[model samples]
Target: MSTSIKQTASSTTNPTTTPAAMPVKTVVITGASSGFGRLACKAFQKAGWNVAATMRSPERENELNTLRNVQLFPLDVCDRQSIESTITSVMETFGRIDCLINNAGYGAFGFLEEASEEEIMQQMNTNFLGVINTTQAVLPYMRKQKEGSIINVTSLAGLMGMPMLSLYSASKFAVEGLTESLSHELAEFGIRVHLIEPGAFKTGFSSAYSFNEGQATPELNRERGVYKKFLDNMLAEPPKPFGYGDPQDVASLMLKIAQTPKSPLRNVIGKDGKSLMLTQKLLGKKRLLKVIGNAAMPKLSA
Candidate 1:
C-alpha cells in the first residue's frame, strides 16, 4: 500500500507555543479504518483534539474528511518503513502527539489445532508487534516532551480463557503483559501508558475473526454445531448476567480514561469483563481453576 501524509497547518494555535502554556494534546491512532478505532477517532475529534487517523488505505478515506479536526495518514503498522515514515509525517504536521492509540488488530478464531502457523503469526504481528512498533516510534516525541499516553486495546480473552479461541487469547494476553510492565517503567519518564480490556461487544469482531481453516476439522465443527442446542438449553435458565455490551459504552469509558487527569494503568471495559475479574480475584487459584476446567473441552478417552 502506498503511504501519503497530507499535512495542513491549523490556524489554531499550539498551547505549547503560548506563554499561557496550554498543552497541545494531539493524538495519533492506528487502525482508524473501522471498529473501535473509527469510533474513537470521531470521539476524539468531536472533543476538539487534533487527531491523526492513520489507516492502511488513505486514498479510500472520504469518511474521515467529513470530520473537522482529523487528518488522515496512510499507515500500515506491519511495515516498519511505513510506520517510521508515518511517524515523521505526524510529527511534521501536528508538532507533538500527546497520545498514541495502538488500535489496529484482527481476531484469529476457531480451534487451535486447526489453525496454521501463518495465521498465528499474522495475528501476533498485527496485534502485538504492531503495538510495539507504534509505541517505539512515539517514544522519542513523548520523552522529549516528557509526557504522553499510550493506549493499548486488549480483549476479555486477554484476561480470561475461552473455548475455541486459544490463538486470539494468546495475542491479547501478550498485550496485557506488555502494558502492565511498561506502565511502571515509563512512569518515571513522565510518560503514562494504559491498557483497555474490552469484553465481547458487537463490533462484529467475532464474525470478522479468521477461522483456523474454515472447512477443516469436520468432526469438531459437527460436534459444536449439533451441541449448539445443548449450550442454548444450558443458557436458558433464569438468564445469566448482563447481555452483550454496546461498543459505545466501552468507547465512552475509554474516552473518560483518556481525558482524566491520571488514568489507571488498566481500564477494564465491560460489565461482564469486570465481573469476571472480580470473581477471579475473590475466588483465587483453586476455585478459578475449577471453573475454567469445567468449561474447557473434555480430553479424548484413550
Candidate 2:
C-alpha cells in the first residue's frame, strides 16, 4: 500500500540515468485519524512527500484517504509489537521512513491523587512510554537510512504544569526530556530529534480526555471535592487568543520543522505557548510558578 509521490515534468535525454527529481521522502505519522496528525498528512502530501498516515483504526479515516500520496496504516503506539509491525509494513511498502512523527498520545485529566493506579499507568504508557516504544521501533530504520527526523508532538503542559493536568503534564514533560536527551545521542547519526509543544488547540482532546472514573470511592470522592473548585476554575477560563486554536497551525509548524535543516530541538506551536515559555525563561521558576498558578486558577487570590 505505497502512495506515489507527486512528480513534476522532466525534460532529460535519459530519464532513468538523470533522476527526475530528488527521491521521494516518506513520513510515518502516528494518530493520523484526527487533530494535528490528520492535517500533517495533508501538509506533507502537499509538499510532495509520501505519507504513511497510521492510526489505530484505519476504517474510520475518511479525509486523508481521499488525498494523493497518503496511505493509512493501523498503528497503536502503546503496543510495541504493533508498532514494529506497522513500521515493517511501511518500510516494505515505501522502502524508507524519512520522518517519524510521534503524535499518538492522549490526555488524562483530573486530580492526580484521586486518579486510580490504572488511570495513571495508562496515561503514562500511552503518552510517555508510547513515544519511547514507537521511537525505539523506528530508530533501527532511521539509523539504517542514516538520515531521518523524529518529531514528537508534546504540549505546553510539558513546559509548565497547570491545575488538574498532573498526569498529562508529567507524561509530556517526560517526552520533552526524552527528546532533549535523544537529540544529543542521535545527532551523530543525522537523526534530528524535534519536539512540538502545542498550546490550546481546538481539537477533540478536551472532550476526549480520560477521566478518573474509578475515583468514585467515598474517600477519593471527598478528596476530589477538595480540589474540584480549583480544577473547575482553571478549566473554565477561556484559552488565549480567544479560546482554542486551529489544528492547521500546529500542522504547519510540524511541516516547517521537518523542512528546516537546523530546526531547534524544542519548538513551541502557538503564540500563547511561545509567550508563556518566554516569560517563564525570563521570570525564573518561583516567579513563573506564581504567575502561572494565579493565571490557571484565578480564584487562588481569594
Candidate 3:
C-alpha cells in the first residue's frame, strides 16, 4: 500500500550516492479534499516536496490523486486508530515526514444555548482533540527527524469570540492555547509548532458550515427567535469592511511557515484577520469589542 516515489539522478555516476538523489521532504496534510488543505497539497508538490494528502474519504477525491508526488490516505482525526494508521502509512510511503498540518475541522454556528450536548462534543472533539491526536501521532516521527514543523490551522475566532460561533470559538481558542504551550514544550526538540489564524475566506468551509440543531423545546425555540437576526447576519456573506480572502493565500503562508526555520509561533492571515488583530493590539480590548459588536449585530449593539 506504499506510494513512495524515489527520485533518480541523471548523472553517469552512481545515482544512489549522488546528492541529486536526496530524499524529498514530505508534508502530511489532513482535510486535503478541499479548501486550504487541498491548496497546500498542490503548493508543496509544486515546490518539489512530497505530499501525503489525508482526507476522511480519499476514495472520493480526484484532483490531488492526479498530481505527481501527491498520495491520498483515508484519515479521520476524531478516531485515534485512524490517526495512528494514517501516520504510519504516510511514514512508510514518504520515508520521512518533515511537516504536519492539522487542518481537518468544521465550524459550528449558532447560539451556545441552542447547541446540544452532541453538537458541543463534536465541535470540541473535531477541532481541539483532533489536533491533539494528529500531533501526538506525528511527534515521534518528527522528533526522530529532530527538525520538523507543525502548522496548525486555527481561525480568527480563536483570537476573538464572535456572535453565533460560541462553540467554534471555544474549540479554536483551546487549540490556540495548546499550540502556544506546545511550541514552548517542543522547542528543544527542533520541532517548530505554529498556528495560522485565517479570517473568513471563500473556501469549502463556508459551504460545510454546521449549524447546531438543538432540540426544538419551547424555551429553545423562543430563544432562537430572539437571536435569529444575529445568527442570520453571521451566516451571511462577510461584510464590506471584511470581505472573504483568497484560500490560496492561506495555503501559501502554510508553505512558507513550513520552509522557514524561525517562523513566528502565531501567524494571522487575511486582511480582515490582520486588521482585527492589529486593532485589538493598538486600540485595546474595549474598542475591539465595540468593533466586533458593530460588525456582528448593529441593531443589537445600538
Candidate 4:
C-alpha cells in the first residue's frame, strides 16, 4: 500500500513531464538498509507513494528490494559524486523527489578523549554532511516544483548533552542547527524542513554503534568500579519495560508531517523523546547539567 503524498502545482514545463497535480509524490530516503529508513520505506510504499530507498549497498538490502513500490538506489551520502549521481538517477526515473529523508547516521559513543578526531569527522560526515549533500541535490527539483519537504532524523541526544555519546551528540547537534537555519531559508521556496527527534528506538542502533576501541578492555580501570557498573546497567540488554520505541511509530509520525498542512519545524516523537526534550527545554541548561552530573556521579565513598 502506498501513501499518496500530493502537491498541487499549476503547470508542467520543458522536457520534464512533471507529475500530475495530484501526482504520486516521490520520497527519497537515505540509509534505507535498516532501522527507521527501512520502516519508512515500507510505510510509504504500502501507502502508494513512489519511494526511492537508498543505501551504500543495494545488494545488502534485498529485503527492502522486495517491496513493490520502492526502487533501491546505491547512495553513499558522504561521497560527493555518489550523492550527485543518485540525484540524477532518481530524477531521471522518478521525475521529482517530493520528500528527502536524511536518516543515515550511527552512534559512536565514547568520551571525547577516547574518540579520535577522525572518528569524530566520520560521525559528522555521515550524520550532518549527508543531509547537506542530499538537500543540495533535491533543492533544484523542489525549486522548480515550488514545493517539497526535507525530513531529518535527529536524536534526543542532539537536544541534551549526554556523557558517553559525545561524538554522536556533536554530530546530531550540527544537524539540529543545520536543519533550523535551512528551514528558514527554504520556507520562501515553499519547502518545509522538519526534524524528527526520537528516543531509544529498538532498531539495533545501539548494537550497531561502536564504543571507544579500548575502553571495553579489562585494563586501566575499565569498569571504573561502581560507577562503571551503573553505566553498564544503563546500556544493558533490552526488553525495556516500555519496549524501545517502534520504527513504525517514527514512520507514522513522518506521514503525519507529510499530511499536515503545516508541520512543526521540530517534532519530538515517543514518550521518552518528548520527556527528554521537556527536561532539557524546561530545565535551564545548567540545571539539566546538574541533574545529569548527579546521575552519572560515582560513589566515591564506596
RMSD of 2: 4.3
lDDT of 1 by residue, 1-302 (tens): 11221121233355244334375578898988888888888888888888899999988987987888789999988888899999999999989988889989987756677677788788889999998999999999999998888889998788766666688789899999999899888888888888888876767564466666644576676655543444445334422466667877765665677778488888887777788788888998568757765654443331
Candidate 4 at residue 43, lDDT?
86
CA lDDT, every model vs. true structure: 0.78, 0.83, 0.87, 0.81
The residue-by-residue lDDT of candidate 2 on 239-288, one tens digit each, is 75547777898888888888897999988877778777778779886898
Which sections of candidate 3 miss by over 4 Å?
1-21, 222-238, 298-302
TM-score of 4: 0.84
CA lDDT, candidate 2, residue 60: 89
> Count of backbone clashes for each model?
0, 0, 0, 8
Question: Cα deviation in Å at residue 251, candidate 4?
Answer: 0.7
Best by TM-score: 3
lDDT of 4 at 200: 75
Candidate 1 segments whose C-alpha is farther than 4 A from its true place: 1-18, 21-23, 214-240, 285-302
Highest lDDT among the candidates is held by which one?
3
- TM-score against native, each model: 0.82, 0.87, 0.89, 0.84
Worst 10 residues of 3 by lDDT: 1-10
User: lDDT tens string, model 4, 91-171?
Assistant: 988888899999998988655665566787788899989889999989999999999998999988888777667888888
Tens digits of per-residue lDDT for model 3, 1-302: 12232333443357566444467999999989999999999999999999999998999987899999999999999899999998999989989999999999999977676678999999999999999999999899889988899999999899888777899999999999999999999989999999999988988676687878774467556556656655666557664676889999999999999999989999999898888878889999788988787767535323
Error of 1 at 69 (Å): 1.5
